[model samples]
Target: MTLNRRIFMIQSLLGTVSLTVGDQAHTEIPVLFEDDSQARNLGYKEDSRKVDTAKFPKYSAGQKCAECQWFKALPEGSTGTCGVFSGKRVNRNGWCKSFVHKE
Candidate 1:
């Protein structure tokens, strides 16, 4: 079988990145802080109860990162990965304007 040129180039690039990053790629993802600029921009609150409804009119009483479609909780923590904040963990109880309820 002949290798497609595009596929070969993609594979080579991925291999290079994997080798270059090595173990560093597996290092723990940092937790997103409430004061983080990205979080502030999105109005993220570590505790859903602490959200200022008057400031964020879109937020509802029950919304949280754990309930958002973009969140993926780790097996053993109160934090999870969020699509809104790539490479960082958000508190499961966190609230952000970007929240989209999981179906």
Candidate 2:
């Protein structure tokens, strides 16, 4: 009886730990990096101010992800989901060629 109880308890502990780790992995959205292939193609800059205007003439001062139509601001943190980057989070101050004013 004692051995059975110990086995059950150990299994329960392992199950709980596994669930917690899995939940965290699923719930966390990965942050988009400027060096990412897709990001580089789109001229994504983590900070709009860092964007190279000579290379991307369409970019203008004050343009940022937070003000763009593709961005969905999260309840917490400076990072938010961008329609341009599926399953990835972008900095609120980030900029990309896909930017469009949120009307």
Candidate 3:
């Protein structure tokens, strides 16, 4: 192959490899928090975008995410199931009245 053609091929191969690596690095883990009777009873919905402590009377300052029984601290981030929810990812910054300290 000519010098120009060889260089072009090499560049193309490198681009493809870089794209593959980037795609693999971005794999997303599904959020573990879902709708639960506990959340529902507390006025929290599965589709709720966020926990509004101001609007929700159940939310209190003592009931922060870190204190929750289900809060799992991972290297990447904290995620875990809520007592009310069967399976879902609650934010580490989340708070609810049902929050219980994990032993």
Candidate 4:
């Protein structure tokens, strides 16, 4: 192949590779409580660290985000507005003792 043709072929190959890789780019999900101002205002602390539910009285069974009345599963995943809070996306894994089943 001629020098110019070889360079053009290489560039075309590189562009195809880039396009293929770009299609697989993953979007990162934002942290729920990057800023705990809302949690703090509600008199609750944002704790991402997992705790032993069996040993913890606060982490009772049937008090999960999925079971909560406010839970609304979006196309992305489970996110919802808390009954306690007017408007906020409660974590799908979040839990509280006051969780109530949606009718």
Pick by lDDT: which candidate is best? 2
Say which prediction, candidate 3 or candidate 4, comes out ahead on TM-score.
4
**Candidate 1: stretches off by over 4 Å:** 1-27
TM-score against native, each model? 0.73, 0.74, 0.41, 0.43
Clashing pairs in 4: none
Candidate 4 lDDT, tens digit per residue, 1-103?
5569889999999999998776443222333462466554433323323434554556654456666686664445655446664445566666544556667
For all candidates, what are the clash counts?
0, 0, 6, 0
Q: Which residues of candidate 3, in runs, are more than 4 Å off?
A: 1-29, 32-40, 44-58
How do the residues 75-94 of candidate 1 rate in per-residue lDDT, one tens digit apiece?
56688889999999889999
Most accurate candidate by TM-score: 2
Model-by-model lDDT, in order? 0.90, 0.92, 0.58, 0.55
How far is each candidate from the true structure, as Cα RMSD in Å? 6.1, 6.2, 9.0, 10.1
Candidate 1 to native Cα RMSD, angstroms: 6.1
Q: Give the winner by TM-score: 1 or 2.
A: 2
Instruction: Give stretches of model 2 more than 4 Å off.
Output: 1-27
- Top-down lDDT ranking: 2, 1, 3, 4
Where does the lowest 10-residue lDDT sum fall in candidate 1?
A: 19-28
As for model 4, its CA RMSD to the true structure in angstroms is 10.1
